[model samples]
Target: MSSSKNMSGGILACENALQRLLEGKPVLSVHVGLDVSKITASIVSLEAGFDRGYLKKSRRAHLPILAKIESVRAEAGKGSNSSSAKKVQRLEDKVLLLEKELAMVRTQRDRVLTQNLQLWERVRELELAERQNKTRQVRLHH
Candidate 1:
């Protein structure tokens, strides 16, 4: 009785990256990491000067589902200073940490549901046994 719900998260950048990669252009460097939920993933786009308009060649990037987050550093001069870069880095780290927490919670919830189902099954078994015992007792008295 475990039905699944279908959903999709659109990533135009990823689609574009894959297309470019397939067209013989190496996938512009990006740190793609699977969200802790493992349900969806995000790829941090890097490499400036990417011509998003160039869509003549469409191809799949074939990037793996769980790509490693190599390194996330603000592009040089993108930030006002190194402190800003550090701040960005910290934010990304926090996001990744939160994702991990979310995944953990999901796993715990699944485990709890399974345990509940088992308990309900046990209750049903006990109820059936009680009913059977009552029938036996009545037959003996008769």
Candidate 2:
């Protein structure tokens, strides 16, 4: 399934679980092989809570499940923060490498341009010498 659809479904499932907890209902565990579907749903819930500050406001309700959710959220938050920091660092390194490559290319271009100008100057000098030599030959023949 697409990530957005999967995330929305997971959020809905988590909301149902939370409502069941609030009403003191027994939560049914949906087992799919070794994976606990409840945890997947809870993770989505935690992401939304952490991102939107919903869990912070819900803390005033004093529910047992909220405490458990808060602890899990704290752990997840730490892991995510560290992973995101690593990704940012990697991207910065790539940018630095690319910038260095660009500088090298620019330097090479400047050197080639200078060489081209020098070659053109030599061609002009050769043409002028040829013209002078032809004039001297014509004078000798006369």
Candidate 3:
């Protein structure tokens, strides 16, 4: 009957709702109609870009908790064989993409290194030729 007891109950309900949201469950509450899809969109928008807009700035405090939720999801996948297989496939695809990028970068680095060495060799040869010409000129003068 007391106001303090009612306030405590309200706080407990909010905490339960948050836990359900973090677990990727649909929260069906009459007072708060929180859609799971809307929350997912909000989280994705906050993390998808380089710019920190108003939504991102306001949601910045939730990033750590969301990251923990992701870890929990990954752990949960292990319990389901099909979900674990899907997760593995996604990870493998990412690894393949990174490997391709790494190979391209290595090829570019090799090309640049070869060009640098060739330029240095040409400079050395030119310097040798210049020294030889100076020597001949000095002998002729003498």
**For candidate 2, lDDT tens digit of each residue in 36-126?**
2133334434433433333333543324445655665566567777778989999999999999999999999999999999999999999
Cα lDDT, model 3, residue 137: 100
What's the CA error at residue 51 for candidate 1, in Å?
54
Task: Determine the backbone clash count of candidate 3.
Answer: 0
Report every candidate's CA lDDT.
0.47, 0.58, 0.57
lDDT of 3 by residue, 1-142 (tens): 5865754454344345446665545344321444333343233333332122312224444455455545555655555577568889999999999999999999999999999999999999999999999999999999
Ranking the candidates on TM-score from highest down gives: 3, 2, 1
Best by lDDT: 2
Model 1 lDDT per residue over 1-142, tens place: 1211111122344444433433435344432332222211222233112343322223233133123212112222333476578889999999999999999999999999999999999999999999999999999999
| TM per candidate | 0.41, 0.45, 0.48
Candidate 1 off by > 4 Å: 1-81
Please give the range of 10 consecutive residues that has the lowest summed lDDT in model 3. 48-57
Q: After superposition on all CA atoms, what RMSD does each candidate show versus the true structure?
A: 20.1, 12.0, 13.1
Q: Is candidate 1 or candidate 3 better by lDDT?
A: 3
After the best TM-score superposition of candidate 3, give how far the Cα of residue 9 lies from its true spot, in angstroms: 5.9
**Number of backbone collisions per candidate:** 1, 0, 0
What is the TM-score (0 to 1) of candidate 3?
0.48
